[model samples]
Target chain A: MAKSFRDSLEAGFTITAEIPPPKSVSFPKSIEVAKKVAGKVAGLNVTDNQRGMMRMSSMAFSHILLGVGCDPVWQICCRDRNRLALQSDLLGASALGIKNVCVMTGDYPTLGDNPGAKAVYDLDAVQLMKLTDGFSNGKDIRGGVMKNHPDFFVGGVVNPFYEPIELELLKLQKKVNAGAKFFQTQPFFDIESVDTFLEQAKPSGAKMLIGVTPIKSMKMLKFLNENVLTKPIPDGVSKRIEFASDQMMEGLKISAEFINGIRDRVDGAHIMPINQVASLPLLLDMVEEGNGA
Target chain B: MVYNAPAMIITKKKDFEEILFAIGDTRSLFLLGCGDCATLCKTGGEPELKEMSQKLVAKGIAVTGTAVVPAACHELDTKRVLRKHKDEVDKAQAVLALICGAGVQSVGDNTDKPAYSGCDSLFIGNSKRQLHYYEKCSACGECVLNDTAGLCPETRCPKSLLNGPCGGAVGGKCEVNSENLCVWIDIYNRLKKAGKLENLLLKISAPKDNSGLAKPQKLELKREPGR
Candidate 1:
C-alpha cells in the first residue's frame, strides 16, 4: 500500500523528484522519467509550466502519474490563471483524487515562449494557500459555503539563499499560517547557508525539503550562477566542477555530498535535476551509497 | 529642493503605418490635439499636430485644418471647440485625434465624422522628467498602499506579489526587469524606516477584491435633492 504524501511527511523523512511535463500532449519523455523514479522517490512533482514555457497542465499530467501508481505533487502557478479558473481547477483536481498541491507565483510570461500573453496573478502565493485552506474548511475564498471541499496537502517554495533572510522568513511563516504543510527550497549548494536558514525556519513548523540541483554541465552552472542565483556561487564548489574531467558526474557527486551532509538536519531533500531527468535515480543511489559509507 | 514631474494620463503614439492603415481611403483629415494630458505626453500637443499635418500632406492627403483644444476629453468643451471650427470639421472626411482613447472617443461623440486614435492609451502615470514616465497606480480599485508604506506593489512589482519579494529580487533589483529595483524590497526598506515592518511580517494581504472591475465601472455622485 502506498503511504499518502502527507503521511510520508509526517512519519519521517521523504525524497521528492520534479518532472517537467513535456509541451506536447503525448509525453513519452515525462512518462519515462516518472517510471525511472516511481517508487524510488516518495513523491513526483509535475511542474506547472516551469519558467512560464507552456506545457501540459500540471493537473492533467498529475492524473497520468497517479494512473501509473506514483504519488503526484501538482504544482499550480498564479501567473497564467485567474482566481475563478484557479478555484475551478482546484475543485477538479480534488474530484480526480489528486491530493498534493504546490502553489507558486509563476515566472512572468515575458520570460517564456509567449511574451505577449497576459499575466493573471489574481492571487499571490500566500493568498492561494489561504484559498486552499478555505477548501479544507468547506468554503471558498469569498466565504461562500462549498458543497464539497478538498483535503489538500498544500506545499510551497522558499529560497533559503534569498538575501535579507528576514523577508524570506516572514513569507515562510505566512505560508505556514496559510496552511502550507511542507515547503521546498530553491536549489542551494552550501550547507552553512542551509544551516542558517533552518535555524530561522524551524519554528515555522512546516516540514522543510532542502533543494539540490545536480549541475549537468559547465553551461548550466554558468547560467544558474550568472542569472538565477542572488549570491555568487561559492568559489570552491565552482572550481571543483570547473576542473573535473567529468563535469556531469562531478555535479552529481556535489549533490550527493550536500544531500548526505544535510540529511539529519532537514526534513528531507528535493532533487531538482532540471531537465536532466535520467540522472535522478543515479543521484539517489549516490546518496544511498554515501549513507552506507 | 526637488523637481517633480507633472502627473498626467500617459499615451504612446501608434506606429505611423498603423495609423495610416486605420485611416485608409480618407483623403482629408482634421488633426485634433489635447492641451492637457496629451500635451504633457507630447502625443497630441500643437507641435505634434503640426508634424502630423505635414506627414499626411507628404502622403498626398489633404490637411483640412488643426486645433489644440484645451481638453479633448472634456465632451462639452470639445463640442464647443469643434463648433468654432465647423467649416474645417465639415470639409474633412474624418478626424485624427492624437490623444488618449478617451479624447478620441470624445471627438467621435462630438462630431458626426469618423474619428481615429493616433495614440495608444498607456497608463495614468507621472513623469520623472521630460519624456520619462513611470506608472504610479494600476487602479486595481482596492488600495494596499497603507499596509505597504505607500509603495504600490500592484503597479510596481512585476509579479504584483502582495506578500513579499518572490525570491527573484537580487541586489535590490527585480528579476523580470533588472533595470528597476524590486518594489517589495523598496517597501521593506520604507516600512523598516517607518518602524512598521510588522505590516508585512505579520499581515498577509488577502486576494484583491476585483468585483469593482467586473464591468465598465461607473460612479455617480449623489445630487443634493433640491439644488
Candidate 2:
C-alpha cells in the first residue's frame, strides 16, 4: 500500500525536486546533481520529453536515480504512445522497479523542434489513470491476468489560480475518482485562489502539493504572468516584482518573501527551476526561512 | 525472354502494424529484412528498421532483434544471420519476415520460430516495370512496332485488325470507350506527323495465329542460377 501524506511526511517539511534528463548519452553530471538534490528533497521528479526535446528515456533515468538511493517519480505522458503501447510500457516500468508515476497529457510535439512527427495519443490523463487502476489491485491491465505489479503512488496535476475554478475542481474530482492519490498543482500566486482550491480539494483524500516555478527576471515574471497557466499577477504582487526595489538582489529577496507568504496551506512544494537545477539549494533555503517564521 | 501480364502490389505501414498486433506479447518478435526486394523498395531498409525499433522501445516493448541478410530466402544467408542474432532472436517469442513468400519459407525451414510475412505478396510470376502491361502476346512479337509506328496493333489495338481509321478512333482518342487513346489512332497521328501514314494500311493480317490469344502459356526459366 502507498503511504498516506501525513505518514509520508515524517519531517515537518517535505521537499521534492525536479531533474531534467541529460542532453547526451552519458549522464554523469545529471546523476551527480540528482544525488545532491536527493539529500535535500524527498524525491526527484524525472521529466519525460520536457519541452519536447528528445532526451535519454525517462525510465532509464529513473533507474539511475533509484540506483543512487534517490526516490524517482517517473513522469508519464499520453503524447506519443497509443493504448497498447502505453499499457505495455506501464507493465515494463513496474518490472524495471519504478514505483511512482505522474500522469499528464504532454505538450503537442510541434511546440518542439520536431514538427513532422505524429503524436500517438492513445489515451488522455484520466483514461490512463483508469488503465493503471489494475496495477493498484495486483491485476494486469487486462483485469483478468495477474502479473507482478508496481506499488504505484499515482498523482495528477491541477492549476488552482487557473480561471473557472469550478471546472478545474470538477476535473480534479474526476482525477481523484480515477484514483489519483495526490495532486501537484500550478503555483500559488494569489493566497485567495490557493485557499479556494484547498477548500474545494479538502474532501478528496488526495494530498495536494503546490507547484512553484520561481520567477527570477522581469522577463520570466512576464512569462509566468502571461504564459504560465491563467495565473493573474495580482496588482500588489506585480508592483513588488516590477519595483519591489531598484536592486535586483533586493527584488529577488522580496519575491522569495512573497512565495513564503503562502507556505502554510500546502502539504509540500514541487519547485520547477526550468534550467536552474543548480540553484535549488538557495530556493530551498528561502523556503526553510519562510517556513521557520 | 519476355514478360506478359506481370502484376505486383505494395502494402502500407498500417498493414505492418496490423500483422504485429495479431502476434501480441505472448510471442517474441524477430524481424528479418531481405537484402534484395525489401531493400530495393526501402520498406525494410535499415533506417525504417531502426525507426520501428525506436517506436517499440518508446513503448517499452522487448523485441528479439532485427537482422538483414544477403537474401532472406537464401538458406545460407538466413542461417548465418539467425545464428549471429540467435540469442536475441530466441528471446523473441515470434519471428517476422519482411520478404516475399519464398524468403519467408526459407527462414522458417531452418529455425523453429514461426516466420510471418512483413510485406504482402501479389504476383503470379510476370513482374515487370513495363510502361503498360500486356494481357497476352502472340509472340509474333515480330517487327510489328516498326510498321505500326510504335503502337502495337496486335495487342494494344482492341480491334486486333491490321487496318487504319477503324471508325473507333474519335477525337484522336479511343472509341473502345477507353480512357486511353486507341493504339491505331496514335499510330495514325504519329505516322501522319512523320509522313508515314501509308504504312498502317499495308493490309497485313497474315492468318493471325491467335489460338494463343488472350490466354496463358506456361514455361519455366532459370529464375535463379540454380533454380
Best by TM-score: 1
Best by DockQ: 1
Model 1 fnat? 0.71
- For each candidate, the alpha-carbon lDDT, in order, equals 0.86, 0.64
Error of 2 at A205 (Å): 2.8
DockQ of 1: 0.73
Off by over 4 Å in 1: A144-147, A291-293, B1-7, B223-227
TM-score against truth, every candidate: 0.96, 0.52
Candidate 2 lDDT over A255-292, as tens digits, reads 35645765566677677766567666666666667742
What's the C-alpha lDDT at position B134 in model 2?
34
Q: Give the interface RMSD values of the models in order.
A: 1.2, 34.1
TM-score of 1: 0.96
